[model samples]
Target: MENDGSAIALEAHELTKIYRMGAVEVHALRGVDVEFSEGELIVLLGPSGSGKSTLLNILGGLDTPTGGTVTFRGQLLRMDSERALNLYRRDHVGFVFQFYNLIPSLTARENVSLVTEIARNPMSPDEALSIVGLGDRIDHFPAQLSGGEQQRVAIARAIAKRPDLLLCDEPTGALDSKTGVLVLEAILKINRELGTTTALITHNAVIAEIANRVLYFADGRIVETRQNAVQRAPGELAW
Candidate 1:
């Protein structure tokens, strides 16, 4: 279950994805081989329609690959049943998408509590919010909060489950530069404090500087990878 210092927390071997549109087939991913490790933050970068999102979706169990193997924690992810995949996502993975997805009517605390209620071993909503530096905003409704605050609540909700893996697809896409930096700070804090293995999908090259490793995608394949000697803080990143 442990990578033991190996940068292989999650791995895909010859992974591929194909979509059938009538008689025509679209290949979204063309045999990608990659490995991500524990206690590291990784940024998946690519242009629009480059399959970065497709790959992130597959890794997060939102989509299935059509070919090859996916292994997480030494267990085969590709062959998992729906029930198993659901359990995997619930018990081990935390996901944050671009949209906040917070309930319009629910206060931030209530929104976060919804997940902790279902989680097997969860941090209290208060604890999660505090970690995201939103301890004072718990009583605020999404509509009453700023876009960044709502997104922070969304993040608190995801991490409240005490998940081992965090998958973010364009988490900062909806925020302005300053707000995005705040969101990224919370993500970085979680990565540093919990040692969670995290993978982020982003179009911004600046975000890559915050990652222990960066993977650049092009035409459904990884075209490059860069390893940082040390990840920089969100404040240190340049657009």
Candidate 2:
């Protein structure tokens, strides 16, 4: 892809990751190179075990590539030190996973407050919930809300920190198609409103329609990349 001179939010050069268990080696990534532009929404589509999650983890500073370089806004990310990576993740990245991972005992507002409290600069929990269209449910507990509602709470929690990057790994994997669209809509809103650079991983090919860029992964590599001239709204997406 040709860069039109937009600032790079994140860039990976020849990224590779290998895991070893008792002399057995697993190559999670194989020389993957990619770049994410500032405020761009990207979707990664692939089958399970194709390394989409691994790539997302690396980009979000949750995991280090065994070989390769990852840079954020022109600064090289050093993964040799856990403290550095932890700081990077805490200050720069927000992650949403397949599961909501909400504290069962905490209300929706309280769950998001947990992140805001530790963040350098954060929005009020109520404001964050409202951004995700969950202001009315802020006082509700996880058990009281539906699966889609719970995921919106998770999204609110992530954006509460006001991180520069939002990484979502199958954010809608656990929801029904109708419900998943709601979750995607929340993510889309965050990216559009807050200008957070976003990367999402999903098995559903249809979700790619909403992304500015779509990367198709297979065998730990990005086999194809498609750029959308006009991105679709989350509500316009079917399944």
Candidate 3:
């Protein structure tokens, strides 16, 4: 459903996640409320164990909240049904994790093709690669490419399905500063060109400058929220 103030692509209300380890309980999230506006790029920033990843997982349907509701396009997420959640994730969400999970034996094109084959409405593998600036490297195997190039291939695979939401958890975490910036550029390019609602989780605060809004997480809660007057290009960031 749309937010009163803006178009809400997705949102979580009164979210909480608690893990039980015998008698001890750990709260990964605590009564959080957040919304992702359509076509906006929002970043979550916090130290380790601050629940940024937890929140991302919940939003992406990889994990369920202990007490809360996640909604997409005004429909409530079915946390109780694995089948529904799987379909939702398969059809609507694109995820890029810190590591490039490309199959070592597959060329970039083939790697991306795996997703397109299953997607109901997918772009060509080559087209996805082109969007990430990897058009020329489509036939290269992961080992034949640099780390940054491989990461871009991973990103291309994620976007090939033409998902409405792109949830990235440290898409640049394994790269050096220059390479990380390249990955960020690819992500921003998708958001700008395709109008994907994107959310990124990063430990580096400099990355926040590239987002329309930033959520500062601490101890299982969003402690501060900042909205940028102007989004800086990823190439302009250094960390």
Q: Comparing candidate 1 with candidate 3, which one achieves the higher TM-score?
A: 3
* lDDT by residue (tens digit), candidate 3, 1-239: 22337688998999999999999999999999999999999999999999999999999999999999999999999999999899999999999999999999999999999999999999999999999999999999999999999999999999999999999999999999999999999999999999999999999999999999999999999999988989999888888
Estimate the overall C-alpha local distance difference test score of candidate 3: 0.94
TM-score of candidate 1 versus the correct structure, residues matched by position: 0.95
TM-score of 2: 0.98
For residue 115, model 1's alpha carbon misses the true position, in angstroms, by: 0.9
Task: Evaluate all candidate structures by whole-model CA lDDT and list the values in order.
Answer: 0.89, 0.94, 0.94
Measured against the true structure, the TM-scores of the candidates, in listed sequence, are 0.95, 0.98, 0.97
User: Which regions in candidate 1 have their CA more than 4 angstroms from the true location?
Assistant: 1-7, 78-80
The clash number for model 3 is: 1
Error of 1 at 226 (Å): 0.7
Give the range where candidate 2 is weakest over 10 consecutive residues by summed lDDT. 1-10
- Runs of candidate 3 with Cα error greater than 4 angstroms are 1-4
TM for candidate 3 is 0.97
For model 1, residues 1-239, the per-residue Cα lDDT tens digits are 22337656788889899999999998889999988887878899999888998888888788888988888979888455888778888888899999999999999999999999999999999999999999999999999999999999999999999988899999999989899999999999999999888899999998999998888899999988888878888998766
